[model samples]
Target: MENIFNFNDESSINNVEIHGEYSLIIVILSIIIAVVASYTALSLNKRASENSFFHKNFWLFLASLCLGFGIWSMHFVGMSAFSLPVSMSYNNIMTVLSIIPAMLASFIAFYLANLPRRNLWTYFFAGIAMGTGISSMHYLGMYGMEMDVVYTYNPILFLASICIAIVVSVIAVYIFSTVQKYETNYKVQLIISLIIGLAISSMHYTGMAAMNFYIPKGYEMNLSHFHSTEMYGLAIIVTLGMTILLGILLLSSFIDRFIEYRANYYDPFTQLPNRRLFEKKLHSPKVLAVWHIHDLEHINREFNYAFGDEVIRRLVYIFKTLTPSKVEIYRIEGHRIALIARDGDSAKQLKGSLKEIATVLRKPIIVKGHEVYLYGVCAVSDANQYENTPNIYTNVLAVLNYPSITYNHDIVYYDSSIHTYTFEREIADDVNRAMNDDELFLVYQPKVCLNPNETVGLEALLRWNHPKYGFLSPAVFVPILEEYDRMVKVTDWIIGRVCQQIADWKLENISFKQVAINIPGEYVTSPLLLKLLTQKLNEYGLESSQIELEITENSFVKNMEEAMRAVGEFRKEGFSVALDDFGTGVSSLSYLKQMPISTLKIDKSFIDDVPISPKDSAIVQAIVTLGESLNLNVVIEGVETKEQVNFLKGASRKPIFQGYYFAKPMQPHELIQWYRETRVED
Candidate 1:
């Protein structure tokens, strides 16, 4: 039959001085392989077009094209180097080499930019499959010597074959995942996973298809003749290596793009995830960690906003030192840095670790030779499915507001129960109402003179009347207010009301004497708060001596330099400052000396259990003795019983006050009514 294949007629027509029928076929297949490889190069170049390195894309594309064509040429040139007769079996082997185009086509399809740079194993796997195909065909061609084929499979060697395939395939995919870069999109991870899966499938199928070559007469296949005859082995190595290397370099360029984009999204101030970065990476099924700088606003007002900004930076540095590599850090707005643990990595231990870090951070950063210290409220979320980063974030925020955990310098992790959250929400609602309705009332816990039955002044205790929940105690709402932005608003309302109430009584010919109001650390820095108090005093025709702003020792010296300066600001404005809860917090001799405070209100805790609880009694005595020596007015609180009052009078702590014993806090009308009623009862 006449040959219909046009390439068969190429020998008779004489092109490029063809040496053998097999040579003609090899050249034809080589040309096709070269063309397909060129297309692969173009395909890769197309993917690189949007890359920052894509300008270098053209160079890579040209290089790939030249190299791919050279691989095909070299394969044939190496084949030509073999000393082989123009046997029919040899012609068949050359025909089988045509499949190289198919392999190249698949390679083009698989080399992707959106995959992980870690999966270069895909390319290595490809090399393994190609090598297997080449080696199998070479052995099959050797059988064309017309000898009986003998099959020998060693168990160890057979197992090694499987091992090599898997190892190479896995490593290839890993390389691809590692080098393949995508935009900051998370799909890149999934894409790399898919590509590795494809590589495994490719290796398996190619290995399955490896078969023996059928030999024809007039061909002697020997190792020496084989080396002399065919450069196919070397061609296989060089060509596949070049192809895999190109894939790596190409994929790696995109990975570099992803990394560069990620770096751009980092927050400059904190070196954590910026707002843009957080929104992008925050995902479903994630845990959120919230870290709050507890005294940032106070820091800003006293030392200037720059100090606050530095505190934020310093906090970030502490977090960077404390967290694990698998944890992702995000700067959530101002004064909060959040950590999102990568793959739930070490998340269970996050709270404890964060607490320790917070304690370490509290040890004062030596900023400009000043020991600048900071504190944090850290909360982790419940490890539940509903916890997308947003929900997890909410959970963590809720914990930061958890009064017991936050106030005590402890970190709290999430619990499934909603009771604490509900409690906090209710308190916030009441606080807001108290701010608006003037329903927020103070209880005058009386501080009585030890020997005399006369009341000198009342230490104002905060109380709230919820339209729904009845009278809410200061213990529940005060700390909540203190931690958030609303504390300043609430404090202003309390101060304004107290001053006005005292004024009305004086007008009524009742000597209300001095009234003490608790001032949150936030209020101390507020110049507007002072102005508000001044306005109220002037309107009510009250003197500066009529009002006292009581602050705890903790609040008085939280940011020492800031607190000292702010106290001076308060004193300068004619409002007297009291060291409320003095012995209870940081009782260093320096605080009493440095603070521009007028009165020392011994903490209610020390006064409540005094004399009976010897510890409490000593604290009371020490605080009283300190105040007496310093010429500071000593006011004792929490006098629930007459026996406690007797103890304070016996201890020589003169002019003391108490909480429960005086009168549980009353409204403005009740306070005036109680004063009028006190004299009537007397």
Candidate 2:
């Protein structure tokens, strides 16, 4: 009571010493705030890369607020530790005003650190500015003290404290900036935060250590304005508020990351697992299968792609209803979806599920108020046998490449025996080479008039002679050409060559009525075919009637409108158009009347068993009658025996015949020689 608290008291104090009491709660809270703020700033800065200006600035603003609030709280809490012999209070105005520089300085610091590209110069300037702001906030808070006392500082310690703040702030900023790129783990971040907190604490204490308090005379008061309870409450409230805010920020950041990951790994349209996630699950043992929509391309070509999309969406919905919840479905790409069964399910069970789905899919769906049916093949691969993702996908895709394995069935398991993919790849290469190297040629099979027993016209056929395989049959290479999309080129070449042959024959005075060329379904709708045909006819100075465009019944069935237009154009230009392989396609009678067909060739299946099988004879007789009524010249195909020719000749109006009974398909020179020989015999 007798002034023993004074530092100058000789009996009570051995040396001139000042005492400070810090609230352990406040110190711990400040450290926690520092760590949380550092984490928030790091998270924000990491996301700032390649972000838009507004996006980067938004995160930078939040980071600044976080760190700024931490700095302000730490400084104020540490200030509450300073103890004196007299009652003291703070100026409420200056106490609130001190937060401005703290936040502004923090904003500058974080902005520079988060710069898309930062140099040493920006870092240095940011550090200095932040340090100045921190120092300003500290001094301003100190000025808030309303006690009747005078304070002075040691210049050296003051300067040292400022330098410590500047140097340490620069180091902290640099660490936060580079930690993300270097993949410095969270432990490193925690350690860096602690070091930063210590630096900040050191600067505050050092500044405090530099100060000396002198009580002014005649400044005594009966009741002091400051209360420890209010200060403690303020510290608690500030710490709790900041802790809650930081917790929310961290939680939101984690949630955003999770959402981003989901977006990357799942398909946007179907909300199913995407190719990225599917590839990741390849190592896990599960039955895998791929559903390929084989007719999606045709559907899209015939109708708009939106109809195709509707089909895919409906199929996915159907598959979802059929599959169990545990099964994983993925849309790998357009018209392809991959299904993976759980470990408990077997490959056989998976195939059954696919079959069920296919059954449901084959049913007609009402799209845009029109009924549309989807056709596809389900190819299953055993994941137990294939461990790698690419191998599994490739093996499954290989089965779909076989021309023999069509989409007519519900499902087809992976058949390793059909080495068609590799074989077809080789054939594709040869066909390309054949086109350029002129390794392919044409042969003409004579079509004879059955009643007169005289040859009328010849049907042109394509033949490929591979250097390795040697004289590959059309049955072998033609399908390969169609598979590889090389048929168009071959068709173009055949048209030009046949037209030239016709011209040459005319020059040789060898008269032939017509040379027929077969066109594939894919090229039936192509404008290029019509253009090429017109160009060849004009180039060769040949009449359109001399060369006939023969398309299969299947082409007309698949695309009736386009095929009709093509045929109409041919007929309009005085060219003859015929529908070949008549009985084999769907609804032969339905299409016969719709097409502009000048000639109808009876399919060989009916002609092969003619005069023996009653059904064959009846079918052929009906087709000939239908052709006659429609004014279409009927040509019977595959007349291999004189019995078949006699059967056709026995009809009231004999149909023309083409097959081995007349003559096998002959080369150009042989055809001319045979023509001369038969003329001489006549």
Best by TM-score: 2
- Model 2 residue runs over 4 Å out of place are 1-21, 28-32, 39-62, 79-100, 111-120, 136-163, 171-191, 206-249, 252-256, 295-312, 344-349, 366-371, 383-390, 419-682
Please give each candidate's TM-score. 0.38, 0.51
Cα lDDT of model 1 by residue, 443-509, tens digit: 6655555344456776666777766434444544566666556777777777777776676677778
lDDT of 1 at 514: 79
Clashing pairs in 2: none
Residues 451-546, model 2: lDDT tens digits: 554677889998877775455546556766787898888888889899999999999988788999998888987888888988998998988889
Off by over 4 Å in 1: 1-426, 450-453, 680-682
Model 1, C-alpha of 569: deviation from truth (Å): 3.4
